[model samples]
Target: MDITKGYSIAYKGLKNGTHDFAFKVGGALFEAYGSAEIMGGDCDVEVKLDKSETQLVADVTIRGDVVVACDRCLEECRVPVDFEGRLLVKFSDEVREYDGEILWLLPGEDEVDLAQYIYESIVLSLPYQRVHPEGGCDPEMLRRFRIVSDKEFAEIEDRAGAEPDNTAWGKLAELKERMEAGPQDDEK
Candidate 1:
């Protein structure tokens, strides 16, 4: 069976009122989408749907943890996910695109597939900077992928620029100068 099928709800026979649905999102959902950023995940999706003659409005909440590469340590890190959003489902005879806030469906469609929406909500809920807490990362991995402090980076740049008489540095500086001089000067 398709992994994403779990996220689909058949709404054709529902009465025109309100309904509640819950789903468990797992690594399978991320794998189905071929997500590179999400190594694995375990999340809960809650949807409160209010259906009427014309439209369906859903209030969605998702919370869970997903594994991703740590920005500072180059190791698998567990990142928390928490998201809440509203989605409007609108039907149209002509094809319409899902524009983030609204999902368009053809009139003949029997089920609403929420695989993409749930996946996106979870992915978007992740913090921009995914990293292990201070000292939480493996010491060896941290040492291997150590990030230079701003001062150290500045010093390295200065040395790379100032030591023009050094063999390797000098060659790099010469190449930089040649490139900056453009094609005409280099040809001359």
Candidate 2:
């Protein structure tokens, strides 16, 4: 059986209560989405659907490990992701905007394919910048990264001081001292 099929609910035939659904997504499912940078792993998805007289409310939760390449070492690392969000589905003769989280569907529509919604929720759960936690990365990789970052920090500090050439500035100071000791250039 297609594992993902369990993630969707046929709200038309449901009773006016709550229904629970679960799905296990793998790399194959992400591949279908086209050009996704997901590694082969299992993720658990739980969806709670509440059927109402006018609309359906779905609360989705995703949790599991995803393998991603380390930004420093370029080595594979497992990143755990967990997040939950809600979606509202409204049935209307004509598409109407209910709210930011609400979606309008045609009255004639029999079922809502929730695959996209679930996928988006999971994707949004990921951190904006996927990086390993401090001290959680490879030792050798950390060493190299430190070297590069240290040099960059030093350059930034120098620029912030507004001395383009430290040595040149020192020489200019010496020249000013000599002029002050001798005849003042401004007096000439």
Candidate 3:
């Protein structure tokens, strides 16, 4: 089936009442929308449309999982999505959108496409910083990062806590003095 076509609500054909629609969307849907932030996902969308003489109200609920790039490891991680959004469609002389939540369409318009709305609802619902739960990153990458991080920490601590006379040349001079005084101390 053509998944993209299902997002349109044909209010003109139906009488004044409530209607229900369901759609299955996944990676292909995002790709078709040319979305770069979200590459793929498996989401079930349920749209409840209430049509009256003057306007239409749509309540959309999206539930499922999305595949996103993990912030820490840059690997694919599946994140669960559960979002609910509302949209108001009003009939006006000219077609325009306002406040991103209201859509105005001409009186004679037969259908309103909701593809963009669905995409935005799902995308905005995602967390700003996407990552795995604590310690869930790739083992190899974490290990390498830890090794480099430990070396950096050691260097920082050494510089912050070391005394002026504790430098490499100072340490060498102290070792030389100790060697010169070793035999004299043993004889005493």
Best by the TM-score measure: 1
Query: Of models 1 and 2, which has the larger lDDT?
Result: 1
Judged by whole-model lDDT over C-alpha atoms, candidate 1 comes out at 0.84
Candidate 2: which pairs clash? none
Ten contiguous residues minimizing lDDT sum, candidate 3: 141-150
TM-score per model over all chains? 0.76, 0.64, 0.73
Number of backbone collisions per candidate: 0, 0, 0
- What tens-digit string does per-residue lDDT give for candidate 3 at 30-63? 8877888787999999989999999999999999
The CA lDDT of each predicted structure is 0.84, 0.71, 0.81
Could you give candidate 1's per-residue lDDT for residues 1-188 as a string of tens digits?
Answer: 89998888788899989999999988899999999999998888899888888888888999889999988877899998889999999999999899999999999998998999999888787898999998888775554345666576456557666544655435544666678787774556
Can you list the residue pairs that collide in candidate 1? none
* Candidate 3 similarity to native, TM-score: 0.73
What lDDT would candidate 2 get against the real structure? 0.71
| Global Cα RMSD, each model | 8.7, 13.1, 14.2
Report the number of the highest-lDDT candidate: 1
Q: What tens digits encode model 2's per-residue C-alpha lDDT throughout 6-71?
A: 456667888998999888878766666652556655789888989888888888888997777767
